[model samples]
Target: MKTYYDVQKFFRRFGIITYIGNREAEIELSLIELQSLKQEGVISDEDYYQCLGVLSYEKEMAIEKRSGKQ
Candidate 1:
């Protein structure tokens, strides 16, 4: 299973920075970045969904960690 760090590393490999703080801010920034990538044709809908999936998984892991459930 992939961990949050793995997801982060994957993004870093592509030169994309991942920010984690203030859930609202993170979501806002992620949406903006994803939109930019889509508009630039750098990623297709499928790729966008895949990336979003990874981000979502990482977010869930973070939540679990913070809640001391992991």
Candidate 2:
């Protein structure tokens, strides 16, 4: 997905909705779900990798923000 909203939509399409009341935790959960979909070959490589990159960046940014690094 190109954005976090798109990520949510992607998961929603598969009936997977994630929200743990924390951005980092939510992203962590999303990453796991996405990885599983990847392993199962349910998601296209392009979409999987794209979403992975965006989510990775997002998770990193969230961690950095929480640690006052950004």
What residue runs in model 1 are displaced by over 4 Å at the alpha carbon?
Answer: 1-15, 19-28, 39-41
Candidate 2 lDDT, tens digit per residue, 4-27? 888999899899999889999999
Q: Which stretches of candidate 2 lie over 4 Å from their true place?
A: none
Clash count of each predicted structure:
0, 0
Clashing residue pairs in candidate 1, if any? Answer: none
The sequence of per-residue lDDT tens digits that candidate 1 reaches over residues 1-70 is 1444554454565587757667645645665676677789877677677667766776676688779999
- For the record, the alpha-carbon RMSD of candidate 2 to the native fold, in angstroms, is 0.9
**Best by TM-score, which number?**
2
